[model samples]
Target chain A: MRAVPRCVPCVLEIAVNTVERAVPEDRQKEAILAATERVSELYRMEPTPQPPRLGTEAQRTVMKYSEDPDPYREEKRRANERAAAVARELESDLENIEDPEELLKRAAAAAIVGNTIDFAVAGHEFDLDELREEISSAEFAVFDLKPEDLRGARVLYLCDNAGEIALDKLLIEVLVEELECDVVVAVRGGPIVNDATREDAEQVGITEICDVIDTGAEMLGLLATEVSEEFAEELSSADVVISKGQGNFESIPEEPFPDVPVYFLLRAKCEPVAEELGVEVGSNVALRWEPEDENVRRWREIVR
Target chain B: MRAVPRCVPCVLEIAVNTVERAVPEDRQKEAILAATERVSELYRMEPTPQPPRLGTEAQRTVMKYSEDPDPYREEKRRANERAAAVARELESDLENIEDPEELLKRAAAAAIVGNTIDFAVAGHEFDLDELREEISSAEFAVFDLKPEDLRGARVLYLCDNAGEIALDKLLIEVLVEELECDVVVAVRGGPIVNDATREDAEQVGITEICDVIDTGAEMLGLLATEVSEEFAEELSSADVVISKGQGNFESIPEEPFPDVPVYFLLRAKCEPVAEELGVEVGSNVALRWEPEDENVRRWREIVR
Candidate 1:
């Protein structure tokens, strides 16, 4: 997606958030400026209606001025612990549910809920209790693909954030043990925002249950060129891909993966993403698409 | 005052609000781009810490693309009616109070509340009842100026918005009749956002109370060069000046009036303003500064 007018402020805001995390108060202004200076340049270079690449750019800029290489280390650790505690409490109850589809959708909703509560985000902080409440009520606009699609098939679960990965682990458990699918979880190559790393996978014990790999995209999204051969092979071999949150929703455009059944389980967190999908903000979206799947097009035709 | 990085999103957000009100949905994109293009130019032309010039610029860009010249007219009228009804209810009880200082501060706070709750603003639409509730809890950071400052003095009240000036009536009542001060109220010469115009002043019954004049600033502040000699004279001759909101705070620099005691009765609505003043968001600030007021300087020194 390319840049929109709304994105500038958001980019600057993200820059402020990233910078504040990295540097002292006095040094934050310069980092923010460094990020702000990149806004027009990125918009000019890229197309309109993009994800939070400005955030990635700002994070990169902030790294230059930062004292700590991974400023979100504490936040990531804390988010994982808190989110894991919630998951640990809920796992038994979720596992006990008889209907498998209900269980999967609920897990997807939990992932969406996790996407909204960003402690690192400026002006967008909310509590875990609120997230729990939001999760319970969230209805997806698209959740057409069933558990049968992934049953006994190779599933690739692309993780979003650190704290969120703990919740994603609950969803992964359902796929691995219940559906009998061979699952591989792919995290980011390096530290960028709160996107999970291989270290987070180890801490969250995601590595213990299933094989975990890292897409070497230093940014939030997965690019084939940026990933290791092992990651690319896993991605290409997977029958069904569940990409959690907005970052993967941004990077992995559907046209490129036409043959792969790509299911996006995310909340439409920003305006551009929401507008592109023609959904309202805070929309619990579980968009599903493959070369043969026609539910989205059929829905559009019905609407038109 | 100049532009800050934080202002980019705010300007775009304001542009979105302004354009959505005036034009059809399709035209909003173009108008928003027009406003965004002006951001770099504005910051380059102006300085780093400006107030709501974004509103002014957005309105101008929207006018270029909009069918309606003043999209905020209906909102302005409704706001004036709602605020006036509230004012009418409070006037008798407020006037019955014997303590002059208590009465003035309450009125000032009411005006600050008015500066917020813009009907034309996208995410900030609030009910009058909500405004009344907010006013009840609102406290001042600085309200040290005594009633003696206005006693038998020529007081100039520079108005901000349409509905807000109606609330300003409560404070003007204290200044004109109770304090026995000569009062002159100046509004905007033309339509811009909801900035009070001569028509709004007349509609809200400013003509019935005191002399009402117009400044040609078009943007919400008083620029001596933009107004007639009559306005310049009224501004210069006033013994005490009460600037209603942030627009004036942005426009009226202290260097121009070294001798004048300018009392800014406002809410630090934006982050930039909040940070500069070292106050929290939604701070009801009644900041006072004269030729040599040293509290602000001393406080800055203490902070540094």
Candidate 2:
């Protein structure tokens, strides 16, 4: 139940790293020195033109969560351990698999398993039967198949947060196993709220599993507006898209992609999304779409 | 500077207390426990139901700043220091005053002096000349003044955050000293963006110093719409009104009160107010208003 709030500090840690990367890599030490001074001046109400906005942003990023005196060092350590476990699992699976498609399926399955375990431990109830039922009912499915489905279809796997990317990798594996598709994994290019970044995807070996690209949007739902020309081309060519999270639900346009199949997989974190899915908040919903199909048409009508 | 942010957690502590007090004193503890759980749930989501309209109010109340940990502890320590310093200064000044009004003046002076010191130490620059200039020009004044002010003009001293009411005690002292007038100290009656609560006032000794009333508004600027009938009558009858902080600025209507004067004292933490005062963000501005005054008109026109 508190997992979302607890996730804030982790998100901030990544954001801090991302912000640090904004400074030229060659001037890393200098930038940090300057950042300290800038932060102090910001705290002191000094006359700095750029300080207010930057200060607010930094304040928002750092102060999003209450600072635990011990600072969740132990929880972070455990998370690293889990990530390492997932990495090892993927590595071993990769050793046995010859085809890229098969590797993707195994990875995706691992992600689902890991996420289910972690979420359950974190007090979230996981209903495996319901999950399977939704997956089977998905129309115009956007998943990576295990070397078997990559004949001509395109697949897009929209990513989530940093530590969660490894779990996403597992989903991609499943896509590869079942769908012989050209898969593209999308990540946010810049910060909007708390979402996964391209760096996070790369760090979790998502780039190795598929052709990864920046969506140029703050939210996954807002991907249409954020997609670049090259990324848009990939999306247009893709037969199915697997969008992860509530942000995608908010931003994905309704009219333009009328016929494209999009599977939205997210844990409903707020009322609006939960109401739309006819589920309680924190419940997971995977709604699938097929171009010109009745269900897709119904969803389009409801969203519009 | 950061002191503004520090105000949020302090106010929230009082907000919790306010919710506790909403029930009978005997059941207060139980009510608080239940409210905390509800608040925790709300905190996980948007925290407040209102959006952009409430953002500024939220920012003012330190709700934006409350994400920092253990702020109540830090503010308690500071408040104690401020109260002690004020008491000592007043004790020394008591030797020179025989009349009750004079004693109130001495107390008010001591509070201002103490607050000035604290504000300066906290890196807020104070401009006494500007404050005096604004106060002298007002026709109607609302003060969060001491009990002594009840004998003179009606004063409405708008309160800011929790724990700072000790400092407000000094302002009340002045209302008692300078004028034989009515004084009404206003606080938010219900859970509001980050403004002070009636309970916070009581804890900080504000209730003892003067008549404490709920303004029924989230921010001071919204007073016109949200203030209760009794408070509105007091405002109508008052000759001079003093408003505190940016919240007041937002809630108070821009229309001039030809017979009434308003003196707005606040630290400009946001952009619009800073621009209005022709000062940088975080600068304290004491704006005096005479409903039909040409200069006040000019200032408003220039800003517009």
Error of 1 at A143 (Å): 2.5
Number of the top candidate by TM-score? 1
DockQ-derived CAPRI band for the predicted complex in model 2: incorrect
In order of appearance, the predictions have TM-scores of 0.85, 0.37
The sequence of per-residue lDDT tens digits that candidate 2 reaches over residues A74-191 is 3333443455455554555455766664454444444433433443134345454454443333232234232433344678777655455666766665565445456899877654
Candidate 1: give its CA RMSD in angstroms.
6.2
Range of the 10 consecutive residues with the lowest summed lDDT in candidate 2 chain B: B1-10
Q: lDDT score of model 1?
A: 0.72
Name the best candidate (by DockQ). 1
A-chain TM-score in candidate 2? Answer: 0.52
